[model samples]
Target: MFTSRGPTLRELAVQALSSVERGYDLLAPKFDLTPFRTPDRILDETAEALRPLGPFRDGLDVCCGTGAGGRVLRALCRERAVGVDFSAGMLHEARRAHPGAVLVRADARALPFRPVFDLAVSFGAFGHFLPRERPGLFAQVHSALLPGGVFAFPVGAPPHFGTLPYWAMLGFDTVMRVRNRVWRPGFVMYYRTFPLVEVLAELRRTGFDVELTPLEGLGRRPDGTPRCAVVVARRRA
Candidate 1:
């Protein structure tokens, strides 16, 4: 469900056909109108869940598309908030939205910042990174954070096996697989690749002490497990 200002079907088709960077560039202007932008509700809840962990110093937002996560950083961090992404267009929009924030254009796998930030938050961008790239990506985030720095992001539970949501995710990933196989400059996004157990282990391997806290505002599953959770990974001190 996108607003009228969102990308048209033709525009979305063109974006899907282009490389990830170029596609984001094309979509940057209308990105906030689409469902792709991280919702404010999730951002606020993430900030609330992280409130007790603060007060933090400089904050960094990894892959901060249009700077939605900057608000969370500003709320928690005492000093400045910085946002980084690979797309120039997204950075441009972010600058317009958050003029005071430091917006950097850099690949997430190789961040330019030192161990300066005490807190970091990323939202809804993990799907862009393939499973094999997770280690390097986590390492990059680890390197950018100060010792004992926090890296927090929300992850949803996988849908029930026979549910429509499950089938939809499966179909989407299958189509993406086929598309990448046949198309040039394939867009990398998979819904089912980032399992919680594997992700927690990867964070540990990256030298982060990982913790999961349920975002109670989003409600729970039938089994009483959280429908979504915040993975709070602290870089080893």
Candidate 2:
């Protein structure tokens, strides 16, 4: 629906009606072409924002769809980068795009790693997790990292209420709620589920010391606050 190489409307419809994992599997081949993929600009700016915080040895990309976060990890990590996702097809595309990175098929809520990585990053996949599931998810990421390891991801400012973008997000989430009500094996994406205040508290509860840094290159909102910020949660040694 986004470009010539993107999925057709019919393909998107099929994906929307399927289970989340199954839907991503169906969309995997064209995922990078779709608007769902993280933009290159976001990745580049993220790398730029993270450069000062790192001298990272190894990195992990959580819910690493099509390897977007892997690219960020490659730029930051000194040794190697690895990506993990539950969708086999997404991992397949990730592997194809990033031949050097190790791609593992695993659910983010139950990451299969010891305290090995020095840094972990996720991009554009938080909506797949419900608010109720976030604590367990954060705990898993925490367990996967080494002492004092950093977990980072970008969060955008909420669109101003009554604005077109705000309404669009509200409508999309409403439709997803209704869809899930009657659907089997619900697809869990929702735009408004991850509120930053609650998220910071949850991360702290999960044993990470959290900090937020404005991504200045992405520009600022009209109120002079950042349009987007990166949440940097560090595991305590």
Candidate 3:
């Protein structure tokens, strides 16, 4: 459900056909209005969950689209906070909404800062990165943070195998696959790419001490597993 100012059906159609960068650019103006932006409830819960991990000084938000996670950084960090994203449009919206924070336009695979931040967080952006890209991405984030600094983000549990939500995600990925096969520029959002087991292994390979904390706000499955969890990885000293 989009807000009153969210993208129109026509705009959504246009974005669906465009590459990820170009689509976000086109949707940037109305992005906050869309359901695509990370929900405020998640932000609130994340900030509260991370409270004990602080008092953080410098913070960085990787692939911060329109500053949702960046706002979390602002609360957790006492000193400087910066948000990085490759989308000019998303960064533009982020700048307008978060004037006090510095926004850097760059690929997450190649961050510009070095041993500068104590805390780093990202949300809802890993879908854009292919699984092959995780090692490089995590390494970049690791290189940017000081020793013992954290890089955290939330990951949702896989949906029921045959449920509507599961099928919906499957269909979306199928359509995206077809679209990429037929299109020139590719859009890289997948419903299931970063599995928790593989992700933890990659983080370990990238020199992070990793742990998962259950996020109770999203509730649990019938099996009693957490519906979502925060992957908190600390850079090794």
Candidate 4:
């Protein structure tokens, strides 16, 4: 769902026809008005969960579009916070909104930072990384953090079997597959590609000690399982 000020269907269509970087650039101005922006509820919960991990001196937000997640960093990190995104348009909008923080335009796959940050986080951006590319992405984050620093993000519980949301996700991924098959400069986002199990495995392979914290604000399913969780992957000390 989108706001009245958000991208119109025609604008969204043009964005869908572009590469991921270009599409996000086109969406940057109104990204927070769309459901695609990471919800504030999740951001607040993640900030609370990460609070005890602080006196962090410096923080980085990986793939930080419009810098909503950077607020979490500002709350948790005592010293400095920076938001990094490959989309220059997104970085520009984020800089205007969050002038207190630094912004960088760089691909997450090959971050330009040294082991400088005490913590790093990303939100709603994993789908942009193809499954095969996740390892490299995680490795880059690992390398960017100080030895004991963390790389965290939220992940929702998979929709139940036979549910409408499940079928909707299936359809979305199928459409993405078809679009990439027929088009150049692929938009490359898919809902079902990153499962929690496989993601934990990748984090471990990239030398993280991973853990999950239930995001209680998102509630739970009928089976009493969490409907959403914040996956906190700590780089080994």
Candidate 5:
């Protein structure tokens, strides 16, 4: 579901065929118009959820595409807010949008930062990472944060089996797998790779004390479980 301002089907197909970095470069100019951009509502809700635990100092936004999460950091952190990503094109848009924020070009798997930030947040970018890559990613985040600093992100509950959303995610992952098999410099986005349990375990193993808070504004499922939750992982003090 994209607006008229978003990329065309042909553009999307071209992006899907390109490497992840180049694809995002081509799409960066129109990314906000696409559904792939993190929604404002989610950003607002996350800011609210993080407010109580914060009064934070310096902040970092990992995989900060167009600086949506950097905006969140600006609200919650008292000092500087930095946004990091590998895509120079995405960082270009981010710099224009968040002129006050610092934008850095770096891969998440090997983040180039010290343990200086008091808070770190990411939005809608985890799908790019494979499950096996998560531990290294978490370790990088942990290493980037100050002692007792927080690394937070929201994750949605799994859709009901056999439901349209479920099937849609399954189909999307299948298509991606097929595409990667057939294509070079594959774009690595997948919907089903980041399971909450596995993620929590990885965070713990990476030395974070993990916790979950339901994003009440996002509402609950029929089973009374939250439809979405914010994962707050803190580095040991």
Candidate 6:
């Protein structure tokens, strides 16, 4: 699912063997060419979904790789937009792509910001965090926002059992687990780790009033459920 401009298999192998930060540093220049980057359609659909709930003044993008989420923030927020990521290389790319955005290098679990943001969004970065790390990650996002602020992210509906996509994801996660077990610096990306029910519970426990809205533009499943939904978590005012 990578383009001609994407990293080579050898390059990807080198990345997989390194730490997450180092891997992203190596992959940063070509990240957007890969399928791993958040697609424009998803970003547009997310902005559309968030439009009604906002008139948001300031926006923050948690784990904003190459500023895709920052672009969304710029669209939704009337005032300033900032992006925070742990990878310096990724932040360099983000700054190049989005010169107007204020980009900071910091870990998601210990975000270095006050409760000043009116809205926060993240894109395609959750897989890097383990299930146990999610609560702290959510708490960091919550603390980075104003009391009435919202944290938003898109989550895909799980694929049907035995389907190609399901098997692909399963195989990917399995390979990652095996790699982590064998390797020194484990790259912690697992596709199947973030279940919706568990995620909603964590958000609630972290003091967010959670809700989900179907992204209609992404289409539906055979059973008529949304293929993807945006999870909107609002900190209690």
Write down the lDDT of every candidate, Cα atoms only: 0.93, 0.92, 0.90, 0.91, 0.92, 0.93
lDDT string for model 2 (96-177, tens) is 8877779889999989999999899999999999989999999999999999999999988999999999999999999999
Worst 10 residues of 3 by lDDT: 1-10
Candidate 4 at 144: error in angstroms?
A: 0.6
What TM-score would you give candidate 1 relative to the actual structure?
0.98
Cand. 3 TM to true fold? 0.96
Per-residue lDDT, model 1, residue 144, is 89
Question: What's the true lDDT of residue 103 in model 5?
Answer: 87
Task: Pick the winner on lDDT between candidates 3 and 4.
Answer: 4
lDDT of 2: 0.92
RMSD of each: 0.8, 0.9, 1.2, 0.9, 0.8, 0.8
Q: What's each prediction's clash count? A: 0, 0, 0, 0, 0, 0
Per residue, candidate 4 scores C-alpha lDDT tens digits across 38-81 of 88889998898888877798999999999999879988888889
TM-score of each: 0.98, 0.98, 0.96, 0.98, 0.98, 0.98
Q: Which stretches of candidate 3 lie over 4 Å from their true place?
A: none
Better of 2 and 4 by lDDT: 2
Q: Candidate 2, residue 108: CA error in Å?
A: 0.7
lDDT tens digits, residues 62-98, model 3? Answer: 9998998877887899998899999999999998997
> Worst ten-residue run, lDDT, model 5?
94-103
Over the stretch 1-237, how does candidate 1's per-residue lDDT look in tens digits?
988878999999999899999999999999999988888988999999999998898999999989999989989988889999999999999999878779889999999988999998999999999999999999999998999999999998889998999999999999999999999999988888889899999999999999999999999888998888999999999
Identify the runs in model 4 with alpha carbons over 4 angstroms from their true place: none
Model 5: colliding residue pairs: none
lDDT of 6 by residue, 138-187 (tens): 99999999998999999999999999999999999999999999988999
lDDT of 1 at 158: 88
